[model samples]
Target chain A: MTASSALPYQRLHVELDARRYPIHVGPGLLDDPDMLVPYLAGQQVMIVTSETVAPLYLERLKHALSGDGRDVREIVLPDGEHTKTLASVERIWDALLAAGFNRRCTLVALGGGVIGDMAGFAAACYQRGVAFVQVPTTLLSQVDSSVGGKTGVNHPRGKNMLGAFWQPRAVVIDTRTLTTLPARELSAGLAEVIKYGLIQDVDFIAWLEARMSALRALDADALTDAILRSCAIKAEIVAADETEQGQRALLNLGHTFGHAIESHQGYGNWLHGEAVGAGMLMAAALSQRLGWLEPDEVLRVEALIAHAGLPVTAPASMSGDDFLSIMRLDKKNIDARLRLVLLSRLGDACIHDATPSDMLDALLTDFPRR
Target chain B: MTASSALPYQRLHVELDARRYPIHVGPGLLDDPDMLVPYLAGQQVMIVTSETVAPLYLERLKHALSGDGRDVREIVLPDGEHTKTLASVERIWDALLAAGFNRRCTLVALGGGVIGDMAGFAAACYQRGVAFVQVPTTLLSQVDSSVGGKTGVNHPRGKNMLGAFWQPRAVVIDTRTLTTLPARELSAGLAEVIKYGLIQDVDFIAWLEARMSALRALDADALTDAILRSCAIKAEIVAADETEQGQRALLNLGHTFGHAIESHQGYGNWLHGEAVGAGMLMAAALSQRLGWLEPDEVLRVEALIAHAGLPVTAPASMSGDDFLSIMRLDKKNIDARLRLVLLSRLGDACIHDATPSDMLDALLTDFPRR
Candidate 1:
């Protein structure tokens, strides 16, 4: 019990000049209008969420967003990562036009990463861009996806191949929502939370290791602390590089290989964070091979990922060639060069595009498979 | 021949802070790599054109774009206004990813408005946006779409219902391409060129009246002069209001009513500029009813549209109610009020959200149907 018990919420800002926005982490934030209404671009508010999330939180959010002047509407899309497509976003744009929503309309994304990414992309292109608020529900979104403003849908050839770097007006994260999240989803989110520790904060990694059990058990303080720290690390890095021109690529610590898994398995087959969990292990192993990370460091990464209930190895069906083929299309690669973010040590990461192909082939071929 | 024959090209810049770019109006620019290569973001270039224009200019443009270390690929889409959909943009994204084009790649839009719009939008979202240049061949594109950076596709619900305000790196308008254009398209292009005059340039309107015949007959000097003046005016307005927030809406003087006609008739059935031509006459007539214009002024507008060989009346299939319903959902409308960009006087326009429903009803009902 600390001041968090009395305050009940923690707030942080992503410093992006005129586009800067706040991320609020707490319990029971879904029912609070104060955290949302101020950031809306205008009176037209459209809440976009998935079928899985609407029943759990829609009415409460609608009530919170309701006002004398505001016009509130919602579209309940089918659930799952497979639904993250241009067609779903088209449905949003169609509804907006049908409802006569205009340039001043604000989109409120009220689900997990799939919902947030799709809703944010819809807002980015709607009327040549409008305002949107992210009311992210799931641990993965609360910690990572909801903060960076990386919004888009996956293509058949790749995951998140089509997207825009459109920032949100605000992010409202409710720890209470995690209470209803499936155990697998909660663990999936922990992968990204652990990623923050592995990439930039060694101390935070130790902190997460000690408190992983408490977080899994739905301990409010632990969840709030974890989300706040993860978002702060993200906000800092994003502030330094808003468009992924430089340091921002470091945040994709395991995403290149992770995206390959997601794209190959079909988007909805594997959870994003789950794919990233195994990807982080692969990155650590490769770093050790490069003499940048110790063998013991790789083991610690695997152990933490395992403790988080995330996959520690690649899918068995995917061969080295499949991974290489899919990874070749990762958005991070420039001018035909494959770039990977690898751990130089426990607390730091570097983007290396000069890895020896034979060494990469050996790692992909010999790496443990589940 | 004037000074035009001496230089062969005229240069103007759209001042958008750091995003400022040039608009080059000339004949035979397709074979001049010097006009394009300087703006290329990298060695990778994807040329997106329509099938109709590919046979005419694709190889010539490719020859010019070809150079040491440059990688150029082309995707020629099926042509037409109806083909403007997310599906087309997806195909563009598919080809770019297939080629492993990176963030540094540049997309060259090598056709009319439809091609420029789709290519520009694909560039806006590919790998979270890459650089793109406008190689607009049609007169309408050279003078309007290529200059303003209003890139998008029409939705089933409305025209240009999906898009982004992604500016191009440069606009290369080759007057010679107009030689291959159909007579109807040349007239359609004139409708937009006429719009610039009616909206902001009284002198240009007078100049156009004197030389409409020369423009229609493809007098190179007259065409070049018309394109330069139109682009210069559009660039000034766009620079002042990049997004259609305030003064920019003035640019849509006939567009609100024009879009209604396009939507009602289906996009491809009516050329955008033809619908706008008839729509502009409707606007002038409505202005007369409001006591803003003389009856002679209305006739003058009608004659100009007729002189351009554009439709001067609404589609026969559309009823006033049909127009009203579609106009209700126009992006410019706010709070259920229908906003119309009406001529306050010749060469000037205003966005009137308070148009009495009865007056609009009368105009829609009394306006002649073709």
Candidate 2:
């Protein structure tokens, strides 16, 4: 084992009734059976990963999950945000049924957010829900998507239009996996880590500003700390609102605008985190217009996003009308009101369904484009 | 409105803590706006029905759910068990998104088991679940699938393999709809009605034996009583075990073999209740071999199923091997052990995972065929 592999892990729990699970973050959790095995529902284990991740870590994950006389299987799906669909989830279900995996089977999702969402969704609907564990191999999933039980696939009409609130039995985040993540992807993940600070932790924003360089350099401590703090904040919010009925919508601070970009640009083009980074800036700008954030706070948000190597501007091709069209279809919206998570202040986010169309149009039309 | 429209509805609650819902049974309940509107989650109501039932009742249901300025919409899917698919469910999600239905929007399932299961499964996963109500138009759904939250579509390899346990806001069973149901479907529905008696209540079995003619003839009073009793039994069981941990398996008394038959026969060829009818008899015969039921008891089970006009024999084309292969894939099995619910006695069912291979083989090999 490498010297980095011996780093001690930190564990956090998402305190959900009956569905409570642990989030284990460290340098080499992928190789630790003790971290993954106890969470398995039964003898059956299905490791659902993407083609991009299989060669890199699938075997080691299987190795860690092996030797318990378990029936271990793997399904390598094509990777990318566009591939997040019911058809992809069906393939996972098909593989499990083909393998004769039952309700007691556990699905271990071993890739980034797309893989985690699709595999976790498959586990949710497979035989009316089975236990699943998240072995997120990307920084984005490790810090954000993997921590929550939100599992679903995107629809042609909107992102995450089809899914379930299926919590994982455990979340295993091995910081070593980040070393294999491309710099752009790591930056995408940093967007969500930044989101935690922007939404609920102002001090975390300062902490991130200090450590952005180290995080970009793949410093183990910096990345691990970011993941732990981000998860802790998310775990608390998700525990309060497991179904996104209320406070949990705060997590989608930039997601309303981000999803529109993703949907309009077509999934995978901008990457969810990249779009979210830009969307967060748009939200901050809107918050400024609403007097919720100072002009300096908006600049701080932009500086942080740019420093993290994320996009600071919306896609040039998207029009104000385009944003409204796609944003109208957002799942967060209830009835005729379009709900967007905005900053009431730094370190505090609020769901706003009463945004005036003219103000939103001005922001979308006036927002800087790439 | 018909005189039967004045029939007082009986309400039964499936006590599932926060997810608990009521099942209302009576004739002409569909035309009563009071029955459906109160259960809807919001002003946006999406009515999911089949082409077969749309011409007959959609207008009335819409009228009842309208006038309150509710944006009630409808999607008429092609009817049949073959159409019970993720693709069909995607169409539902697509329609919901197309209509801009939000998280609080309600999906009203307005057909038989196939429609109820598909729409409920759609609601279970649409934006991670929305409120839904069951407006069951057929007997099978009214007494069974609509009461419990076991909603899903069948896979090519298995029946109801992909789904979730999402309870409905209410179940509105209008006995008047059964007046237009085909004679064959009425028999199919009776199979499940008979199952409730066979699994847990011998007195109900005797009561059914006396009332079978009345039920088959569509006697409103007899039908309502059967519906109420069946739903009460299902509600009690589902309340105790919402996710089918232990006692819920008793409800699947004939479903293991039934699903095998359905899968082998190709879904939609034999109605789900028809397959269950024959499968229940098979379970009885197997129970006799296991010395749990006397030969006369097996005959009584056969007589009841046959009297209900359901098949008393397995399909002529299927072999012992076909049944074995399919039954081996039953979801109730765990860790390579095949679990089947068999009769412990009249009105009492037991889950058996230890039936001797030779005995199961002999029963399968010697079982009567059409």
Candidate 3:
């Protein structure tokens, strides 16, 4: 499939004050190496990928990167969220040094969010920083993580506990990789897909309801359309608040609760998207309880998440108190104050300062048995 | 030793393209916390200092940091070149995440070069990249490491083999700290002092010879003046080539051969400054052998380094063949070609493409019976 043959897609630009980059979306786009040529002006290239995705796509990327007379090299890391650690980062640094990579080299991230984060970080530190390209493979990364340029590894105490907000030269998403994704992993990707609709686009939420079946079936047109729209919405929000200073906080609608669930459950016990699926349902319920959202709206969001094969309730082992304690350590918290992004309506949200009692009561109602 | 009572020192700035920063040198500078106020506008503050320096100065800094109602935290790592490693970085990330540090935070490196590099690397990774300040405690850091904004930990395979070129918001050099430095460490600092003279400051070299007695006696005024000048030359070179692009290569006059000597001798076997001291003499001999420098010029530089009580000869353990093999792994090499910075005259140097045979002969003659 060739990029030129695919349907035209919208281009969303993230305007960082000095370092600006564009996010391009469409079908069959990965095959077009010309789009990446402008950023690869240098001769040295280092591709960072993971074990699961490397064997499938690294060679193709190497060939595409070699188009501009650049010397191509690659470092393959272990797959899964567990690989996001200082130990893993050390491996990347060793590889770069062993290869004699300098500040002039370009680092290409060729896997999912973990690969993108770690690779982007390696580029950020290699000679202070080098150019980086994001080639997101997973659906979760394509819609969210790949767009913002937030890169780093996780600590045992929290998710994304350590990281930086360094932007990429360009982001390349190849929907072709989605064809090989397992059904369970594909369903996990829908969590972030649903997040975009719930935050700032009601019309898009309704659109997802109509096409959710097609997306789950991996229909090419439906999946591509969903991805392009998600990227466009994200690009707009990120451009306005690249560093998460203002409206960018809206993007974390369910992340505060989502991170708590992930942290309490022990990171890999549940995939990040799965936790977010359950977290969004909790946020909607809390919004209804707070009189900010209608009860019917809460039901609608929960139904969509359940229909998409995502968990709509907190993990059975986690008590209401456990969730509360974990959320306190969230990055959004200021001086131990718990700040949550709660829904005011399907397309509108606000960052609310929630009291400990209010949060405890809401949690008990959601996790009634506890 | 209040800043208000001291004579005003001239300021020199390092122009890093879009990100320019100033190098502040004077007595009692650290006591004036207002100097750090501009860079501390972020949400969280993590100060990376060493055990040796922390007990002596951390409280004074902590008091100053908390003045603006910002949340300031400190993490103290073991002191030494050996402490700069991946394991140490992991400890830093763990401490950062445990303290709830995020992208909006600024890491203040409060020790010598090792602390600055390790902390700077942590800041670079903690959330992709965050702002950091360099408060160099030792002369080596004040004159060399802190100014470049190059941050990273050492890999098991090599020194500074893993890191980034992330710049600092500001560099604070308090000459008062040098009063606490051990005589051995003070002499180690002189290694870099002689470096500026060997590279591109003949007049500075002549200046150093005239005041070697005062400097050896740790005269505060003379020491601060030398530090400011060394930084000025480095800032100019770094500004012209922030990433060692062109003339910045001159900074590595002794580094290539220095790194080989350090690696072969076992890192920590010789202080980095000590190896560079000897390495500078070897590079001078190699330059003379290549006819790029006169014999008299080599003797002058060698005499200055020896006068500072620094070793001017390589260790007996490092063989000529081993030195050549190790230097090839340096990032400065281009496609198996070894590049070395050679002095053309006092205060001027140029990078040359030296062949394996010429390099081997220089090493053999320079380190006979090795």
Candidate 4:
């Protein structure tokens, strides 16, 4: 159960009965078709990827999958949050049916969080739910989006506004795919890595703080260890609460505030990890205001976010009322009442049904207009 | 249990843990707000109806639900098979979001199969999945679509080619709603009513043959009894095999051939139930040709379809090749193999892995060129 002992390898199973699947985390896991082929279910495979990742790793992945009897097809979507729309989802469906993908076929999502979410949503609806595999190529996807069964496309009105919580048959994380990722993207992925620590893993957070430099330097050992730990934590949480009824809300530590920023700033304006970083800072500041955390503890959270090269403050143009309005529409809100997943302390979080007035007041003070 | 004593007034449950819900069938169930309130889960309810049903029953259902102290909203879609599309689905999503419907809201589909499918798909994708209730107003929906939890909009390329199997919290089938149904629409619904009998209910077929006249006349008792019996059978099948692995495919008895005819003649050109009516004859003929069914049995199916005022023959315009190509893309087809559910006898069905060449030959003979 210890991080080191569990490192360098471990398989976490998501027990959804017949739909049960495993998340394999380690170096070079993606190259092994044996890890994925068992779940293929049929001969036809469609690997949904992005323009950016196509040139780098799509060919290798395609080669590996098509090496045997598998008839692999690839559809490259435009890279970015902009492509997560109804139009894009329709295109994926068209390509899938065009390729004669029957209900037995599998859809393989081969990129970051956007690809996984969009592809998974497409799979969930294509012929009323087909099996899908998550070959998450980004650190953020590998650690978070890939582990959770949540998949969806963004609507013009909201991010991830249209989707399903369809768990993938398997998630293949090849840490080597990160070699070509941009520095900013890598840092954004670390934001989620840092979140696991801030929300429920004090020991892991301590370890992350110690290995921050090594991770930034793209040390294979550091990256793999972080991913393994993140997936394990997420797997445990999701297994307990498949849907966000109770404890699963804890995983949305920064997401309520983060979604507001994402929607207000326009999706793709801030990388999800960046918005989450700033959102976590806001949560920490609010926790400090409520006397749940020491002011110094709030500073530590902000410092870690800043050190990871993520935004620690809200965007300048967002007003308190604007943030509150956007957050109120968040799916987490019940009966129009805003619910925030606030940390009681580092490594411990609770869902707070904060009054709108209190939330707005806290947001106003923490992110005051200049 | 005897048919009348078999819980004539009881609720049938589709057990899926937290997602489990009941299907209440009987006279006067629609006015009971208590039956619908528990599933609402929130104060905001959006009732998706059609131009046809809105003028008749929307207000009554709204009033019934209003007793629970919740805000009720209704979106009236154009009344027809043509309205089941991405465009209409987007409108439903837009209306829900515009009216401030968050994840906590419930969508009540208060029309026939088209509205139920489109509205259900909209709910499935709305914030990754929300609760929906089926208030199927047509004979087709009451007996079939409303009970099984299969929901989706149709694509221009195919009927129900785009959808999700998102279960509803409950189904409210008001047999009174069929009182205003046109003679043609009523007969169209009978196509499905006959389907249950063809696949696995010889006794139901005999009952329908004996009572077809009274049911067509919209006799209150006969219609309600038939709807309840069909729904009970569908509920049991769906409960055992939610995803159509084996037994569920039996329910698609005439759908494969019916979908081809509908797609070939153009989506709205043929009433879905009409096409299925004719398609069932072709499947029966093919079953007889394959020595699985007797010629007399095929004649019996054809006679019942004709008695129900449905076409038991293919239209002159469609070609065998066109029908073959369309059936090839059916979701049920595994790999390039065309797997169809064909009747071996009156009360049993088997998944036949028919060769494409043989099926094409059968199509050519059944729908000979002009």
Candidate 5:
């Protein structure tokens, strides 16, 4: 057995009753096979990855997990948002069964958010809950989806419309994998990092405003600082309300509008974080119209989002009715009441339905160029 | 809405930390819309039922729920053990999306175990959980699957091999529904009624022994008494261990062996409880071989199961290897060790693995005749 001292990592614990687990953040986690052994309960392991990620780091992750005579098997799915379907989840179940998996088997989600969501869900229903570990490679996943354990596949009507709140046993965030991440993909991830600042922490927003250039340049220290802070904020929010009943809705600051955009534009046309980044500006403009945030603050939020290479404008062809129609089908809606999380000001957001429909209609038509 | 005080019903509250809800047991519950209204979160309600159940009671249930400007939608799936597939669940998702159902929409499972399981799982994953009420129609589901929060669809590998633990908002059990249940189906239901007595309460066992004929005859009083006691025992077991980590597993007394038989014979060929009934005899026989139960006691257990019109012998075609092969694939297996729930005495059963393999193999070969 390898000594524990060999693994250099920083641990952040997500405390949600019995579903509590750890998020280990650091470089060289792939070298520490011991990090995985303690969380796994059996010899059987299935590594679920995307075609985009498999050729890059699949073998190394497999090598890391093979330390304790583990029976490591894998299934590589087609890449992108299109792959997050029930058909793909069924294939995972098929692969696990073909390999003789049982309730004791552990599923290792070894890619970005799509792998984590689909694989985590596959584990949730496979034998009614098996252990699974997340190794999120993308910066967006490292900051948001990997730690909170909201695992689900996208539905045709809306994004993440069907799923379970299945938590993982552990999340291993190996920041070193970001080295090979495409520049645009990294910028898309910065959108979520920017979200953490716009929603909760102002000091962190100040930090990002100063160092976003370093983040774009793939500076290790800047990226680690961004990932660590974003995950910590999310961990606290998830711990408070794991099921999104009340306080947890704050995490969806731009998500309601973001999900609507993704569904309207089709899943792959715009990245999740890019939609979210643009959606945040819409929310900021609405918050300003509600007299909660000043117009200048809305401009600040917009400029920062644009600086991170995120789209700040909704598709010109999408009428107000298009936004209203998709938002009506949002999974977050309670009895068709379209509730959205909007900033009262920078660094604080609240789930509100008080925005007048005509005002929202006007904003959708023009979206405040100033 | 009709006054709740006018509705005749008995309430048993299921207490689990935050998931506390009630099971309303009565004769005329289907006549009272008020009983359903309190549990429902929104104006939108989706009733999920089997084809057999939809023809029998769907309109009646819908009429009862349609009061006070509610939007009631229905999804009628094919009725049978075979319909509990992930594909069927996706279709339910499709229906919900097509009808614009969201987080506040309540799912009403209006049939037997298959409907409760599949619908409950659909609720659990529909926007990461919506409120769901159980209106279990079959006697078996009324006494067992409906009471526990164990929800999932079956995989090809095994029965109920894929699922989640999602508690219903409320369970509406109407003993009147059992009147329409087929005669053979009634006998199959009695197997679970017999099981509760065998595993936990000897007094209940003695009670069933005296009144097995009346229960088989579908005597309303006998059936109500049986359902109440069985539900009470199950509620306590589930309350103590909602996830089946410890004491909750004792409730799965005959399920491990029963699942193996059902898998080998194909699901619909042997009714679930019929297989469980035969499985309980195997468990009792093994318990006797372990010197836990006397031979006379084993004979008595067999007699009671047989008296309930349940199959007491294994199929001659299934060799010992067949049971071993399927049992090895069981969801209850802990790291390759096949664990069985066996009787310690008439009133109690415990999870045991100490019985030698040769003894079990010998018994399966010749299920000893008296």
Candidate 6:
């Protein structure tokens, strides 16, 4: 279905000093001919997309970006979470250099998290960084990866081992594209939507409990509100701390546990948001054991993830020790201490590191891959 | 020869507000273990050196950096300009990740410009950027690349196509290392030293002309003075314009022509300073055509380069069009305009874009690589 003209957009400002830019969320924004023009710093533009997103949105994006005497180029790669890497970045570098795009050139990332990360990273280091605009097509990217300006590729040793904090000129998030998302992908996106409510907004949690089904059904109003609130919450946290120094770490409530799930299963076996959804349950369970959360709240967290069609348990192959080992590899670890973001109470998340290992091991026995 | 204990050290401050650091030029600094400890942010210290430098000073540096229960790792790359590439950067990234060096880890560069650029670039992107220290072993890097925050590696299509502007935490330049430098390389470095005079310091030009022989002979006092003055001049320029917006372009007086020379010959074929020396003459000739320079000044520029044992002419294989085409690819070029840093008069330089193409072509036919 084509985007409705009556649909509204929400604009949130990141306000990162000189790097501040607007995150525009709306329906039919992708079809807007001038959506990307203002953020561009030069006439030389390149769209870095994936095999999947290119076929779906490449023509529309190209049409909007071209016909202005602009020198536009495209570098397409196979789609996968595994492809968010330096090798892919090299291919992008080759394309930009072949087209003679200098520091002034602007790279438009027109796909999900992988594309945004790879393209943004290429821009960050190409001639010491070029301006970029993010046109995140996937729901997960719109609410999470594309907004915060944390761009990097994975290394064999760990996820996002090489990266830079490069802010985009603008985030042109077109929620209309969510209509094309697969069911699993759409549900995975809601995990982060649920994350916002879990971390800071009890009222939003109540709102999601009522309206999440509508969002799952692709209801325009519900989906738009979920995305808008998520972006606003994330923007507020990032504006206070752009580099994930303190408050920003709250946004990664489940990501530490999530990263291990992805790493243990290999990068693409379980999608990031799926792992995060399950990982959030683990955090909820941990918080309950610490007496920061009630047993019912933990059950609600797991039930909500399961309702969204996401896994709510770690893989059976992963022991508590295995999870502990991988978690220690996290860049956030200070002097080998495993620092985690756990909910101190439902609707209020906090970073915690004092949980006993024996308690964590005993807790893992309750939830298996099944 | 052993370094004299009585040689007084001089310090030059870069003075960039938040990026400010000191350039310390002295003798026997390698023996001082405390030199780098304060700048290091963590116990994890990695030394990135070259095949040529490893045998000479790596052990001294490693010994100094260790024995304090510090975690030190070494990644030795092959020496030369050819080593400055993404592949080299990957080796570094691999080593850092393998060693589990986080953002707080320090990367110490212990070679010439090539090593300094590669290590600095690695440090810039490893975990979004780690602090680095520069221990330049060559004259060129000591006075030029190591002082500024410019860090990057070369691409096949151009020089330094991928890079970042990551400043080192501190620069430790041990003048004693230069005593081991090849005579040809030492002379090549003088080209940049003379450039400081031609661009901003007239008195420095007169001083160099009077004492060029003493420096060439490796007279400790003369060499010490030239290196100190050159670092101070460069530190001042970088402080005023950290990222080549306006005044910094003057620092590239002959680099536009020189980069084309390096690219055409294949990087590491002709020495960077040798090409810059010759390129400086080309700029002087161009300036004379603009009626901004006298014939005698052009002759002196060429003669000074010749006296320093650097090339005074471009290669015969490259026609004027070749220079123009390659130079247009320079990062400084905007909207296809070929911006060049040309001498307006002796002891002064400015960026010029109005030089007629026909004139440049006519001038190129006069100089050829014999």
TM-score per candidate: 0.92, 0.95, 0.85, 0.93, 0.97, 0.95
DockQ of 6: 0.70
Report the C-alpha displacement of residue B287, candidate 5, in angstroms: 1.0
The order of the candidates by TM-score, greatest first, is 5, 6, 2, 4, 1, 3
RMSD of 2: 2.5
All DockQ scores: 0.62, 0.80, 0.39, 0.73, 0.81, 0.70
Per-residue CA lDDT of model 1 for B49-74, tens digit only, reads 99999999999889888887799999
Q: lDDT per residue, candidate 6, A1-370, as tens digits? A: 2243344677888888878899888887876655668889989999999898888999888877887799888889889978878999999999998887887899999999999999999999999989999999999999998888899998878889898889999998888899888998987888898899999998998888788778888888787788889999998998998877798999998899898888888888888899899989988988988889989888888887887888977898888778877888889876666788999887899988778887777776665665
Model 2 residue runs over 4 Å out of place are: A1-7, A316-319, A356-358, B1-7, B265-269, B316-319
| Models, CA RMSD each | 3.6, 2.5, 4.2, 4.1, 2.0, 2.7
Cand. 4 TM to true fold:
0.93
Each prediction's fraction of true contacts recovered = 0.76, 0.95, 0.58, 0.85, 0.88, 0.71
Report the C-alpha displacement of residue A69, candidate 3, in angstroms: 9.1
The global C-alpha lDDT for each of the candidates, from Candidate 1 onward, is 0.90, 0.91, 0.80, 0.83, 0.86, 0.87
TM-score of 5: 0.97
Model 5 lDDT per residue over A14-75, tens place: 99877788888887786578677678869999999999999999998888888557899999
Compared with the true structure, the alpha-carbon lDDT of candidate 1 equals 0.90
lDDT tens digits by residue: candidate 2, A132-188:
999999899999899879999887776788889999999999999998999999999
Backbone clashes in model 2, listed as residue pairs: none
Q: Which should have the higher DockQ, number 1 or number 4?
A: 4
Give the winner by TM-score: 4 or 6: 6
Candidate 6 chain B, run of 10 with poorest lDDT: B1-10
Query: Judged by DockQ cut-offs, is candidate 6 incorrect, acceptable, medium or high?
Result: medium
Q: Which structure among the candidates has the greatest DockQ?
A: 5
In terms of DockQ, which candidate is stronger, 1 or 6? 6
**What does candidate 4's lDDT look like per residue over B1-370, in tens digits?**
2232232344677776666788776656666676677788688899999998898888888977895578899999998888788899999999988887888889999988899998899998899889899988888888888877788877655667778888998887666778788899899999988988888789999999999999999887788778777777777788888888888888888888888888787776788899899888887877777788888898899899999999978878777777777787887887777887778998777788854577557655665332
| Regions more than 4 Å wrong, model 4 | A1-10, A355-363, A366-370, B1-11, B15-17, B67-69, B355-370
Q: Determine the C-alpha RMSD for candidate 6 after optimal superposition of all C-alphas.
A: 2.7
Candidate 1 deviant stretches above 4 angstroms: A1-7, A67-71, A263-270, A315-322, A365-370, B1-7, B98-100, B294-303, B311-322, B362-370
